[model samples]
Target: MNLKRFCTRFREMRTCYVGTQVSFLDKIFYVVDYVGAFIVHGASISDYFAYGFYKLRYNGRKEYITYRRYHIIQDKCNVLSNRCLCREKNKFNELFKNFLGRAWIDVNDVTEEQFILFCNQHPILFVKETNGYRGIGTRKIETKKQDVKQIYADLVSDKGAHYIVEEQISQIQDLAEFHPWSINTIRIVTIYDTLNDQVHIMNARLRMGNKKNSVDNFHFEGIGANINIETGIIDTVGYDTHNNTYITHPLTGKQVIGFKIPYWEDCKSFVVKVAKNIPTVRYIGWDIVIQEGGNFVLIEGNDNADHDFQQLHNCGLWKQYKSIIKYF
Candidate 1:
């Protein structure tokens, strides 16, 4: 790892170290185990705390996959996803137009006149960097209220970064009620088995914005609850990066647990079809927003899907994932 990332993880390890309630001897064992794992499996110090490896060893189970190991598996599975056609925002929208279900324009490609027309058509715009992750470099713009010409100029003038402006999605009213300011989305991770030619929905999570944020990204102070893949119902309490837990939405007091996602069966079929579209990228994390009348739109797909969020409740999925991906 680089110095910057190492320093950040070191700080996090220290925080977790201070907060853990284990005895002094157990703490020494934890550090030793972490060091050995870091050297052998390329695991980070934060991984030890995140997966509760300190406790898992005593329980005689070593099935948790670390952050580095997850990337290694992703790299092996996504050999062709490196092309960037599907990962980049503009190309992905153009490539998956049928599934996007929304209008979008690449600021780099459109002229000032064309941009003005797009703004007029879409009063509220969701602007994002072409390759941004974790909801960074994204914003909601009110084209009718702001200076359209200035907005267009600013977007086009940004050097070395491509931006795509999309029509704001009006989410289903039931899901929107939990966080009216943001479009709450479901993050469904899929694994395509090349040998069997089947798509498997590995895990799902309901991501909802908190503190009035416009995007429901877990990294941006949003809350995420584990969703039951079979029933499409949220089965766990909401969790955030700061270790805060919520049984109900902090803003609206809406119940998070047992909330059923609309069009559950359709969502499974839609993602399965989409997964088959790019067989080379076998593992993917798709962010979907359910619109009115039970139709869902594709927000984005992540080739390097995150593992920490889904495994936060002390359940390790290493063995299960290995069983499916071993043939590859």
Candidate 2:
């Protein structure tokens, strides 16, 4: 353990305790529980807070898969997902071309002339770093407002970072109406059981952009709600990073709790096929966008799927996860 980092996190957690109105006795009890969880369950302080282990209702807190344990699972399961084929944006597009459903070009692979043609073809483009996550290093470029030549020059010389430029996706009408500023997506986590040659849909969540942000990543202050895997209906209220809850979108007034995702069965089958295709990468978190006519497109795959957002409703999934993967 890094003592310096631990101290820093403790200080940050202390601020959260006070801000969240945790009483002094409760704070002391939580600290003790946190330390005990760290030693026994390999949980981080943030995991303790994020999983609501400090709350009275979470009596089975030990059943939650904390950050450190999630990493351990990733290490054991994602044997090949860390490779360039999945980790790098350009290579991922090449590997999963059939599902991308859009035109894209790698900055390093295209000449100025080819890039100019790409820009002319798509008025709105999403420029993203090859290995970026959580919406960092991503930009929405409107070709009509900016010079194509300048955009090409900047992309090529942006500190040696590789970028993949792709056409913007026009999401399904209902989702678009809910948050027109960003493309709301479904995050479906799949676990491929090698022993049984089966793909299991472990968990799913509906992520939506809040306050007109360009991305729906929870780290970007977006909201996420639990999706019932079998019914494809959102069953819980949305929650944000700051612990704020929403029954309807604050901006668009769309009801969140009972909204049904379009083409639900197709979405499930789509990811199962993808998971089977990459058997070596046993675990994956897939971001999918529903197109205007109910077709779904792949955004990206995460080998180290997040454990916090899926458990935001104070439900722990460690036992369910273990039963499926049996890694522990």
Top lDDT model: 2
Q: Candidate 2: misplaced stretches above 4 Å?
A: 1-8, 11-25, 56-59, 80-82
What are the per-residue Cα lDDT tens digits for candidate 2 across 251-291?
A: 99999999998899998999988888776777789999988
Q: Candidate 1 versus the native: TM-score?
A: 0.92
* Candidate 2 clash pair list: none
RMSD of 2: 2.2
Residue 247's lDDT within candidate 2 is 93
Model 1: how far residue 105 lies from native, Å: 0.5
| Residue 143 C-alpha lDDT in model 1 | 85
